[model samples]
Target: MNAIELSHVSTAKPVLLGDSLTELEVMRDVSLSVPEGEILALIGPSGSGKSTLLRMINRMEDPTSGRIFLFGSDIANLDVKELRRRVGMVSQTPALLPGDVADNIAYGPNLRGEPCNPGDYLEHVGLERELLRRPASALSVGQQQRMCIARALANHPDVLLLDEPTSALDRTASRNIVELILRLNEKLGLTVIIVTHVMEHAQALATRVAMLVGGSLIEQGPAVDFFESPATETGRKFLRGELAEDGR
Candidate 1:
């Protein structure tokens, strides 16, 4: 069964320019499916709505029209907090709370009066347990990102949504994060949807690739086929960096 599905989803925002009102379409009738335990990379040029599309899966941004399903259930019908707990999200930058590492990791479960052992989650993200008491701000950017992943994992989510997860990291840190994501998916059978501007990261992490251009899905297929023999001219142009602000 598909872990997540977007059926005829579209989003638009009203914009006012010089006293004239206009509707800006962010996504246009997009339909996509992600199977269980699969890593699907969402790629496109800047302003192509890749991030917007990812955010919609978790209802961080709701679509103006259409529906989203999680494990065959309509997400709109689910309680928002429960939905978020089931679908964890990690943004480009780690937004840690103003506390030590352990506090940040325990925040989610604490809200529900549940117990959380921070060390176990830290191990999942390849972080040492000794840092549990360290201040969140003291950790390096890479460590902070890993901590964010750990915090999300503490929720025991079925699906993980990552938006530009490695954009701010160095090459070494980025590669570490990619490996960590692969490990989590393998170990926990987590379905992952990642939006990335780096082709190399997508190539290394994604089992399938989906490309959006001008807020529309242009092509999507197995990773090997999409990388080597893209079906559309726009996809090819994106690979060759022909599109303006490509892969941002």
Candidate 2:
């Protein structure tokens, strides 16, 4: 079964809540399928609703119309808390709570009454055990981001969603996270759906690339074919560094 599937998914919200109340459609009829254990990259220009699409998989925000399935089960019918546990997310700017690294990593598992050893997970995300008691604010941005990944993994998720995970790090740090992602996918058979603006990075890590433009999925295919000769005009322009929308 496909790990995650979106069928005619759409999202709209009030442009002006109190006075105007005009509905602004952020995503329009987005349909895509991600196979189990596949690292699929979601690429798009700014305001293209890529993050919005990612949020829907974990039900961060419900779709205004259409349906989403996680491993053949409708997300709407599943409990929101359980869905989020199964679909872990690591954000672009990770929010480290008012505590040490260990506290952050143990949050989810502790909530579920599961025993969580910070050292084990620290190693799991490539961090040293000595940093367990260090203040979260004291850590570098890269280390904090790794903590976020570890925190997400505490839930023992089947799929991991990463949104611009390496955008803020230096080249070396970015490469660290990239390699770690690939390793986790290979070793654990984890399904990863990563949102990235770096075309080269996507090409390096993803087997397939899905292009989202103007809140719509323009094209998606094998990474080589999609980058070599994109089926859609928008995709072709995007690869040539000429897509209309702005921002990474």
C-alpha positional error of residue 51 in candidate 1 after TM-score superposition, expressed in Å: 1.0
**Total backbone clashes of candidate 1, pairs 3 or more residues apart or in separate chains:** 0
State model 2's lDDT: 0.90
lDDT per residue (tens digit) for residues 124-192 in model 1 = 999999999999999999999999999999999999999999988999999999999999999999999
Best model per lDDT: 1
- Per-residue lDDT value at 50 in model 2: 90
TM-score of candidate 2 against the unseen true structure: 0.96
TM, every model: 0.96, 0.96
After superposing candidate 1, which stretches have Cα over 4 Å from the reference? 16-21, 245-248
Please identify model 2 stretches exceeding 4 Å from their true place. 17-19, 246-248
Ten-residue stretch with the least lDDT total in model 1: 239-248
